[model samples]
Target: MFALRMSLVILVADVWAKTPFMSEYEFSRRRDELIREEREYAGHLRELTADEKIVDNYLEYLKWQEFIATEDKFLPSVGLEGVLDDIVNSKVFKTLKKFPKGGNMHLHENHILSKKKMLDIVFASEDFEHLHVAVDVPESKKWRLDFFLNPPAGWEKVKGNPKYTKEKLLPHMTMMGSMTEFAKVNPTNSARRWEEMDPMFSRLGSKVIANVNIKFKYLESYLKAALEENVQYLEARSSISSRLYTLDPDPKYNSTGGKRYIDETGGEYELQENIKFIEGFVKKNPEFIGMRKIVNSYRGASVSEMYGDMEKAVRLYHKYPSYIGGFDMVGEEDKGNSLLYFMNDFMKMYDNTTGKSLVPFYLHNGETNWPDDLESSTNKKDPVGTLQNTYEAVLLGAKRVGHGLGFFKHPYLLNKLKEHQTAIEICPASNQLLGYVPDLRNHPANNFIRMGAPVILGADDPATFGYDHFTVDWYEAFMGWGLRLQDLRHLAINSLKYSTMPKEDINAAIKDKWEPAYQRFIADIKKEACAVDFDASTNAPAISRIAPREGPMKRSTKVYVFGRNFEEGICKGVRCKFGNAVVPGSYISGQHVSCNVSGLRRRNRKGAGKSKAVGVAVSVDGGATYISYDGQFTFVRNL
Candidate 1:
C-alpha cells in the first residue's frame, strides 16, 4: 500500500511539472503588480494635465523636504496642535494656501471668522458701545459677549474696560484657552473635549452673531477671508431661526416684542436677509463665485423639535430654492440623538413612498471614535452610539456625510457610500483637535479616500477651533495622508462636484471660473521662478561648489549647483541667480540643483566685456529668499 501511494504521488508531481503551473515567487510577482496598479487606481480620480503633473512632482519633492526637516517633525507622530506653527510656516503649506480650494462645504455660519478676527471686527463696530461682557462669572465661564438695550445689573460694556483687552478676550472667545484646560485633564477623552467645546458656542459664537449688527459684517468678513484664501464658494450650515435683533434706543420699539432689542428678524425674513446679504457680497466680490446656506438644526433636539426644524427647512428650501443648499443636524454626534431616533421625522419629509426628500440631507454622522456597542440602544431615551448614525444617514439619502470617523468600521456602509457617490466632508484639524484621532494618520478619511469614496476637506467650526480659512485643514490632510498633488486636485474638483450647486452651475464654475484660476495659479507660480531679490532666512540653501565653473553667459549653459538644504520640486519659485539675472532651475537632490546659466545681466564692472566671476545664488521658496556660496561662476565669452 505504501509503494502504491508513493507511485501515485510521483505521478502527480510529474503531471504538475509537465503542466507548467506557476511557482510561488512568480505568482507573488504578478499579484504584486496587480496590487500596485490597484493602488494607483485608488489614489487618482483622473489623469493629471501637463501643468498638474509638474506641480505634482514639485509637491512630492516638498513632502520629501518636510520629512527631512528636524524641528518641523513628522506630522503623524506629533498631532496637529503640536505642529501647527510648523505647518503654517511650511513651504508646502504656503503653496497650498495659494490653491483655489473650490468651496468650504461643511462649516457653521457663526464659526466662519476666527475668534480673533471676530473680536477685532466687534471692537471696530458701533455695537461695541452696547456690547457687554459677563465677567462676574467663574474664571472658566468669563468673557461672554451680548448686546443689551438697557444694561443688566452686572454686564459691562467692552469699550475702555480694563478687563477685556484683545489678548485677554481672545482665549475665552476661541477654543485654545479651553483646549489647554481640557488637555491638562485628558487629551484623548473626546467627551471631555466636547464638554469644553459645547459651551464655547453659547459664550462666544451664538451671543456675538445673534446681534443683527454683527451678523452681516461677520458674514462679509467670512466671504472676504474665503476669497483671500482663494476659496471661491461656500455652503455654510446656519440656523436662520428667529433670534437676531439689533440694539436700538426708541421706546416705542420695545412694544414690537423685539426680545430686549429692536429691529428683530427671524424665520423666513432672516433667511431672506441672509440671501440678500450673500447676493450683495457676491456682486461686490465677483471673484467670489457664490454662497449657499445649508439650514441646520442641532441633533440633540427631541423628535418633535427636529421634525419642526426639518419642516421649516423644507419650507425655506421651497421659498428660496436657489439659495438653500440642504439640511443637516449640527452638534457633537456621540452625545446627540441618533439618526435612528429621527428616522420617522426624516421620512415625513418625503411623500408618495418613492418621492425624493423635499429637503436634501447633509447629515453630520459618525463623528465619534466610540465603538458601536458602547450605546447599542437606538431608543431615544438611551444615550446614542454614533456608528449606527452612518448607516441611518446613508439609508436616509444624505447628500454628504460629515466627519464619518466611524464609517470605516462598517464595510457595507462604506460600499454603499461609494455606490451612491456620496461625499464625506473631512475636517482633519477638527477631528484631531476634538480628540477623535490624535494621530491624524489614523483618521478614517484616509481609508475613505483610498477606497475611491468621494472626499472633500472642510473646516468644521474653524473659529471655535481657533483656526481661520480652509488651508489649515488642507495642510493637515495633505501631510497626514501623504497626499499627492493629484489627490489635492481631485479634492478641489470634488468640492464642486459634490456641492449642492446645480449641475450646470457646477460645470460652468469648473470650466469658466475654477479652471481658469487654477491654470493662472500654475502660471504665476512658474513665472515666479525667475524673479530676483529673495529675502534670505533660516533653512535657506547653502551652496558648496559648481561643476564646470565657466560657462557662456549669452547662450544657455546647464550648470550643476551643489548645495545643502536645497529644496526639491518643480521650480515654482525656485531659481538660480547669476549676478543680477535670475533664471529658472531644476532641483536635482538635497545636495544638487541644475540651472540654465543664460542671459546673465552683465554687471557694471572694471572688466567691462571679458569673462567675469559672478556670484551665483539659489532660491527654493518663490524668491522669498536666496542662498549663495563663496564659489563663483565665470561668465566666459565661450565655455
Candidate 2:
C-alpha cells in the first residue's frame, strides 16, 4: 500500500513541477538560472569578438619558443645577467628586428643612443683631448668622463690621465654598468650615494658631447637605428632641464667642477634652436614618418619648481604647436611630487589662460611600487600611492599615462581610459626591471586589452637596459605575455591611433602607410609558413583558412575542418594530423570535423612545433582523408 502511494505522489509532483501548480519560489529560481546562463553566453560572445583576427604566424612563434626555452630565470634585465640582453643577441631578436613597430612614443632623448655608438663618435673625433674624466675608481676600473669642445684652460688634464685607455674609455664615456656587479663590491647603495651617479650619467651626454653640431649627429644616429628596427616613427620625450651645453664655460667658475653650466637665466633660446634643428632632421629623414616632440618638466622639482617647468613647457608647446606633440612630468614618479600636489596650480593656470592649452598633459603618473609600508615614498602621506597617482592623472586630462603601473590597483581606470580613448604608453622592459611589474603574464596590460583600452609598447630608457630600438619591447610583449602577430598588429596600430597627432592625419597614415605595411607583413608570414606561393591573383583553396585561431581553447584545441568538394571514398574513416601528433579521437562530416592534437603546439621536447603542416594528402581507407591546409595554429600557452 505504501509503494502504491509513492507512485501516485510522483505523478502529482511531476505534473505540479511542469505546469500551473509550480511554486513561485521554483519559478523565480528557474528564472535566475536562465539569467546566469544568459550572462555566461554574453561573456563568451564578447571574448569571441575581442580576439583580433589571427593570421597563421609560424615563424614568429618558433622564435618565441627558442627564446623561452633558453632564458635565464635569475637574470635581471637591468644587469649583465638579464635574459633580455641574451634575447637581444639571439636569432629571435634578428626576426623581431623586421617587425614593423609603429613608433617609439616614449623615448628619452638623452638615453636613446647606445653606449657603443657614443664611444665610436667620441673616438673618431679630434676632440678626444677635450674629453675629461671627473671621477675615477681604478680599484674597480670605472670612471666618469666629460668633454669640452673648446678648452677653458686646465682641460688638457682629461686625456693626460693614464687611468683611461682606449679599452677603458668606453665605460667611462657611458653610465652603462652591471648593477649586480656594483652591488657586490659596494655593500648598500643609499639614495644619497646613488644620487652621485645620476649627475654623472646626465653629464655624460650634456658635458662630454658638449657641442651643438655633434648633438645633431647624435639625433641622426638615433634615427638610423629606429629605421633599421622597422620603427617608422618617433615621439622623443625630452626634459626641459637638459638645456644644451653652453659653448662658452663662464670665465669665473672652474671647468671640471661643472659650475660653468649653471646659468641664472634658463636656456629658452637653445631650446628654440634645438626645436628648429629637429624640424630640419624631419626634412632629411623622410623615411621616418615624422618624429614629434613631447616637452617634459623634471620630476625632481619642488611644487614651485614643477610649476615653473610647466610654464616653460606650455610656452614651448604654444611656440611649436606642430612639433610639440604634448607636455609631461618626466622623472621617477615615486620620488617626485605627485601630480595632485600641483592640481591647484594647474587649475589656476588653466583659468588664467585664454583658451585650451595646446600642451595637453601626458603625465608619467603611476609608475610606482605603491608600497604597503607608510614610509614607502619621500612623501609618506602616499598610503595608496598607485591609486592616487592614477586618479590625479585622469583628472589632469593626461593625454596618455606613461608606464601606467598603478592602473592595476584600480581596474575602473581601465574603463575610464577606454571611455576617454586615452592611450597608455606601456614600457615593458623598463617596468620589468623597475620592480613595478616583475612578470608580463600578470601585468596590467592584460586588463587594458580585455577592456579594449588603447596601449602602445615603448622602449623606455632603452640605452639604460641596453636595447637599440622598440623591437626588444615587442619581443617581450610576444614572449612575456603570449601575444600573437594579430595582437602585435593591433598594438602597433594603437600606437598610431592614440598618438597626439590629429585624427585626420593618423587616419591618412593608416590608409597610405600602416595598412600597406600590414599586408606585406601578412604576406611574409604566409610565404615563410607554407612552401606554396601565395598568389594575389589566384583564389587559394578555402581549406587553407581556419577560424577561432587562438584561445584558452587554442592549446590542445579542436580544429573544426572546412573545405570544398567531397568524395565518399576519401572521406571514409578520415584521419588528420597536426604536426607529428595524430588526432586521437575525431568526428568527421562532409565539411566539418574535430581533432584532438590541440591544433596547436609551439614546441615538442625536441624543440619543433607540433602544429607545423605542409600541403595536400588523401586516403580512401579508414586511416585516411583528402586534406590540405597552410600554416600551423602556433599554440599560445598560459595566456
Top lDDT prediction, candidate number: 1
Residue by residue across 1-639, what tens digits does model 2's lDDT show? Answer: 999999999999976776651433334345546666754532322221111111323443354345556565523223322455676776666766777788888887777887678767766666566576545333232344556545343333456566566565554433335344553233223232233334435534655544553566777788888878878777878766554453445555444443345333465655666667666766776545667778787755677877777777788777766667777877666566666667766775563456455468777767765542322346654334434778877776678988887777777876687778778999876666555555555677866765567788788767744555577777667765656555676787888887777889788767776677667766665454344222222233245454434322244544445553222212133466554555543323234344444434333423433323333232213454445566444443332
Q: What is the lDDT of candidate 1?
A: 0.75
Q: Which candidate leads the pack in TM-score?
A: 1
What TM-score number comes out for model 2?
Answer: 0.69
Screening candidate 2 with a backbone cut-off below 3 angstroms (N, C-alpha, C), the clashing residue pairs are 147-208, 556-598, 557-598
Cα-based lDDT for every prediction: 0.75, 0.59
Q: Please give the range of 10 consecutive residues that has the lowest summed lDDT in model 2.
A: 45-54
- Candidate 1, poorest ten consecutive residues by summed lDDT: 529-538
